[model samples]
Target: MFGLGPAAKSLREQEEQAITVPASKLLLRAVLNLVVAWFVFDEARGPMAWIVVQFKPSLATSVESSDTVNVVMNLLYYGPVALLIAWFFGRMGRWPLVWRRYGRPLVRRVVDAIGSRSGAGTPGKAPTGAKAQGEVVVDPWWAFRPLVGHGGLALLDQETAAGRVGDVDHQRLNRALECVRDYPDRLAALLDAVREHGAAACAHPSGTRDLPGRHSGRHDLLLRQVRLGSAEDVPKNPAAYRGVDLAIDPALLGTSLLAVGPAGTGKTRRLARPLAEALCLQALAGTAVVVVVGAADADLGPAEWYDVVVAPGDPASRYGLDLYGGARRLEEAVARLADALLPEELAPRAESARQALQQVVVPYTEAYGRPPGLRELALLLRGEPVAWDALREALRAGGGLTDHQYELAQRERMHGQVDDPGALLADRLSLLDRPALAASFNRTSERGGGERGGGRGAGRPGAELPLFAMHALDHPLRVRIAVPEHSHPEAARIIARLAVGQFLYAASTRQDRSLFAGLVVDDASAVIDVHSVRSLQRLRGAHAGAALLLRTLMDLPESLRTPLFGAVGGRMAFPGIAPWDGKLFAEAWGTVWVDERDVTRAPDTSGGIIKRSWRAVRTILAGERAQTESVTTRRVERRRWSPSDLAQVLPGGHAVLSLTAVDGTPVPPLLLDLQG
Candidate 1:
């Protein structure tokens, strides 16, 4: 029954009508009682008549006179006998009312004693009240359900009232209780404790563990509980509910973290900054190697923590990213660079450009025994004979180049076609030629004066940029590269793409899974592509992870969004999200069945009129009676948190975390307020 109208009337109104009898119903009940009384009297009258016959034998001889006398005597006996029987039956009809008024409390007290002794108390029992040892005070209604058992009520209360336990923990506790019940000694001790105090008395102390500066274990980077939301009434025990502070285990993070939030929502300050700081602490302790990529103008915490700051196009920066430093082989480096410069949709052109660039790169490396910089590569693509002597010497020493190779190089030199694929690639890469940008990549030294021919120079093998070098993952290194997208959007994207590709390649090469690595990219939507998606999918196995911050998913191509969502092991969504994004999260969290309680009330007017009426000598009494009933129903496959609720209802500084469990199941979405 559904209660869907005005508020309920008071209890006094209900009780007043119960005692006052209704004239019509009372008359009907009285008549029925009189009929039952007559039946009772008839059964007893036969025996009485026999006794009378024994005393007056002469009266028994005359049948007609005896029958007449008997009828008269039976009539005389009806009033007293019937009246007495009717009163007795009337009392039986009121037994339920009597039990409710006087018997229930006595029975309830006995049940409470049994419940307390068994480590389960009544619903009204206060948690702070003195409970018997090992007694678990819980909602009595929950205890009646076959599924809930004794401990389930306590777990449910913790989850609903205190928010101390989660669904996963609830299931675990159920299993643990089952195990404890199987062992007599342990079970006895547990019950004793529960009876002595209440269930909450056994809860762990409310405090968090101190995070060490460094940790050897890969999974030790923990998100500490900074604050709690004012709106949340749930009391939390830091020790008991460790999941409140997210633990980004290496396995979970290996796939990646996708954080989506609007600007000025503390995504950077709360999520990104804190995560970076935690990673840096691990780096300082020599546990992990971290790379953070963001705009040059953004404040990404302390600079001292970073071993190298590579700001492309920032003349003041001390380090630069070598585009070719990602791979040991020249072909691999060229392919990776081409992927960064060209979108996958331009497959034909991208492939042609990669092949054209590799032809020059491979030949040049063979000639000069070193990789060329952006400047040297540009010259070669333009058909300049800058390294002709080195080429000729290498050719002579290697017993001469094939005629085809020589002809191709000579014809390119002679023609110098501007429309060539190699030239097109060079044009796209020309951004690196800018004075400020080129200076960063031109030298291996702190300043750009180490060589005449840029960082690697001719015949001088250059050290790989830390971003790509194999050894970089082995050390506690922090590499921060700033690409100011506003001034140089293409350059920023190219650098970001290259950094991501290099990290992915390096991650795939890792032999030791214990050492963890991570890449943090702020405003990543601008740079995410097919390669980034693949990298996210593969990173987990290599003990490498990524944290990508995006303002929205609108910039992402529709085809890539699903894969991107599937690839990341965790997602955090802040308030003010678009409806579509909220829907995605809603689906990720999925649906669950929940219990819904419906209460209904109907007017009950069964009581008769009272005798105390006066004004005009007319009787007056209460007109309506209220009857209430409760019914529970199930809501199956309903979304746990609706999209509209998440998009608009969540307060500022709050976000929902949908993290993947190690078992590959999605954990239910949890509401978290980082700024709390």
Candidate 2:
């Protein structure tokens, strides 16, 4: 899908076809020649002698009509062969390919003998070295993909025909491409180093280092920014930013972005789709690791851009989620899963829920060597006596348990007797254990693909389906996960929350901080909470980032409104949001010093006799009072974007976007024309 094969084939055919003479032109020439023949053989001079005498004085003699007939026949004898010559010219470009494919095989011995003496000359074949030297650069990125040999040169011709390549870049890229042609494997080694050591792979400059100036090792790529739209000339927008190009690159994304927009305000088209695509390309360049989470129907990007597509909502999905988020310690497992399952109102009981999950999870893992799946955990939490009895029996059968583990397992049998928090946690697990997601959460069924016996499928080898675990992203990989938002809103929320918690846990504990890891929660109403917001504050320092998309500011709790806005560096507000939501955004954007002009007109009071008499006369004549005008200008503090402006003044297909670079530089909010 990425290489230059199709373009090369077109170029090869174009080269073989030397000329393109349309059949209509040939047919017109034939008709005209036939008309000439008719006149030359006509009885009257109906123009035959007149037209012929213009070019040939012999026809003017009119001596011997048979002699004239002989001359006309001689001239038009080769007329049919003219079409033959045109056809040959069109097919001439294929001779080299024909010789290479067919002629070389029949007489290999003779061709080799001739080649041994001619040094480099061949009838239709170009020597490998000369072909490499003839390589013309089509795209600078072609060199990064290492498109070498005749295919590269052929694509150059194709690009010229398409008029997409300029002469300047063509010449400049050729100089860079020559270095790749000289040492093809060297780029492969350098790319390996980049994938291993992050931006430091390009720490030093070499004799032939050529790439975009905006790229460093941390977020290097053939292109720098992925354009989203442009800032328009509007009163709300700063004059300095009007008609300016707006884009988001990895450097800006490194600080994390928060996009707040309703469903159809081009959030998916303008923000999510572009960001996901950019991150996918960066992943291919071996510079970033990305995970995009969205609804099943959201058009974030195509599935092909991702290495693993974990569509938990789609029954035909080939990947399953690791319910425990790859946590090793038993406490870590209980804490992470409990955070995902418990309702927001029950957040105060988080510690109690953890204790309840630990009561069953520790014993289950002690017995089965892996954490409990959704079904097992749900049944255990339901306070079913039979399920607990069986689990306790299984834990006792395993004699490998230590005194503390066995003691904990024995204590599990009394879960119902105590005021267990399992009831609260079990109420939330009902969403995961639904019929639609029967084969989803546990991830052990064959339909769910082969899973290894590890803690929630983290780096589990020999699995047919991939597991969505951030701890396993030591290498560059792009993962896209889709949750069922419409049919199962609550379930989608639980999964979205789980994915975010998993990402935070992994990012906080990752050892190899080289790969710039990023997560995009397209609909984050279920994910962002008091806990996740706190974790997001540390993302900038961790060299990781996230893009949280919310439909409105009201999705966040009242207490979390300011913190959520403060935790992110890049912020956006799509058109048509509520005035209250815009108020929060206005407060977050803060105030700006504006030049306020005030013009007041007051009556000329206490004037001279002439002025008073004139004012009286003018008032009497015009039936109005006379006044003097006064103008005042001063710098005053005002909202950069007022609540009313953000709510109603923003035109359709426009959004207010602000940016923060990875190095902490800020750009004030400006109105972006999404269509532009």
Top model number, TM-score: 2
lDDT of 1 at 506: 66
Return the TM-score for candidate 1, rounded to 2 decimals: 0.58
Angstrom error of the Cα, residue 207, model 1: value is 32
Model 2 Cα shift for residue 366 (angstroms): 2.3
> How far out, in Å, is residue 144 in model 2?
9.3
Mark the 10 consecutive residues where model 2 has the least summed lDDT.
204-213
The pairs that clash in candidate 2 are 16-93, 16-94, 199-217, 199-218
RMSD of 2: 21.7
- Model 2, 311-402: lDDT tens digits are 66565676667787545555885788888887677788888788778878777777766777788888888777788777767776886345
Q: What root-mean-square deviation over C-alphas does model 1 reach? A: 18.6
